[model samples]
Target chain A: MANVSNETRPLSPHLQVYRLPLNAKLSILHRITGVALAFAAILIVWYFLALATGPEYFETASAVLTSWFGILVFTLSTVALWLHFANGVRHLVWDTGSHLGQKASNRSAMIGLAFMVVMTIITLWIAIGG
Target chain B: MRFLTDRKRVEGLGSAKQGTGHFWEQRLSAIALLFLVPLFVLPFAYNLGDGYEEVRAAYAHPVNAVIAIAFFVTVSLHFFQGVQVVIEDYVHGRLGMILIIAMRLLSTLFALIGAYAVIRISLGA
Candidate 1:
């Protein structure tokens, strides 16, 4: 390691320095879905705890969920769920030591996105229709 | 024995004995959740009549009750394993490790209680 200026510390292929490729984008979305899962799980816990407490508590949660803000959170969480679930299947495929090639990987990513849209539409249809 | 010492030399992280059980159980639970998640989500999405009696009736089904318990138990077990790994990476001290262990144990207990509540409510006991 030679003495190098602080600004030139051998760039480690940062995202800002280069365009994000498809595989890279999928990896980023995988991490984001994980964080989203945690947040959604917490909201679930709050709902269950409310249910356990009593009717009044449950009603409060029910009202909040029916509110616009709550609906938005639910919609976002629904999208996150579909995205994560589709990508998770891709991960399961990789776990079995298949689909490591570039073409297969890109195709899987595209399929995952398409599946996410379909699931989101179905989710919203049921959400709004009922 | 000489064989024992040789094995020890090669195996640095001594086997904990229960980790694989935890892993397999978590996986099994996740598979079960594939069905359970949809079952739960559909009812909510439909905005079905959600009176206490209706809720109780839905949960009281043997299939629903059993799956609900399994879902919570497996979810907590998986979360504990994941969070423990995170703590091992970042905590890096005896006290920190102990704190993490305590938190994990507490979380498991909370999950147990929640599961118990679900069972009781479903049974109307």
Candidate 2:
């Protein structure tokens, strides 16, 4: 590809220039939750590796999960879980050719946010001694 | 000097068009995330007793193991695609681009390895 001169080209809607609309915010949240889940991959590896080595190893793994840091990570993972799921459902609805209009788009975004909050609360409840 | 410089430039895409692959993969991962998220969330509600053997057995169950593996794989792939698009849009400088690429590659590899390990342990290997 040829290098184009920035000066000659008309201004484009770059990240800063682009107004963050409902759809845009939801899109960014999806990416953020994705990154969060990527970090949770470490827990998955730890669990599996512990299981492979048997009961003693598994206890060591479980103990870490019960600690403060483990609980924090677990809580974060739950939030990521709900956020991704709710946003994903929104994406699926959009895929079905619905919710493209302004009113419906805002509604979907609100619904997604509400669902994520409710789900996260329920998840944490279950995680912490519920 | 673009197309005139190379015959490869004449081809629109590579040998295979990958639009469908990417689309379906994204959807499949999304669906997996939907179910896996709930299953993972549910397990944390009830405290697993403080017994090593009990906890081990709970995880050793083929179903639990399978679901965990599925969650690991789907979550990782979803993250991989999401981060790639973000990096492509936001990364501009040479150093930034390199960092983005490195991040994506490592994230994918880590996800893949974690998923593989989960499957092996879940299957009782």
Per lDDT, the best of the predicted structures is 2
- Chain B TM-score of candidate 2 stands at 0.65
Q: Could you tell me how far off, in angstroms, the CA of residue A8 lies in candidate 2 after the best superposition?
A: 26
Candidate 2 residue pairs in backbone clash: A126-B45
Query: TM-score for each prediction?
Result: 0.75, 0.73
Q: Please give the distance, in angstroms, between residue A93's alpha carbon in candidate 1 and its true position after superposition.
A: 1.3
Predicted candidate 1 versus true structure: per-residue lDDT over A11-63, tens digit per residue:
77776678888888877776566555656555555555566667688777667
Off by over 4 Å in 1: A1-12, B1-30, B47-49, B83-110
Encode model 2's per-residue lDDT on B16-70: one tens digit a residue.
Answer: 3553566668788777777887785477345432565555566667887777667
lDDT of 1 at A111: 96
Error of 2 at A63 (Å): 2.9
TM-score of chain B of each: 0.67, 0.65
lDDT of 1: 0.69
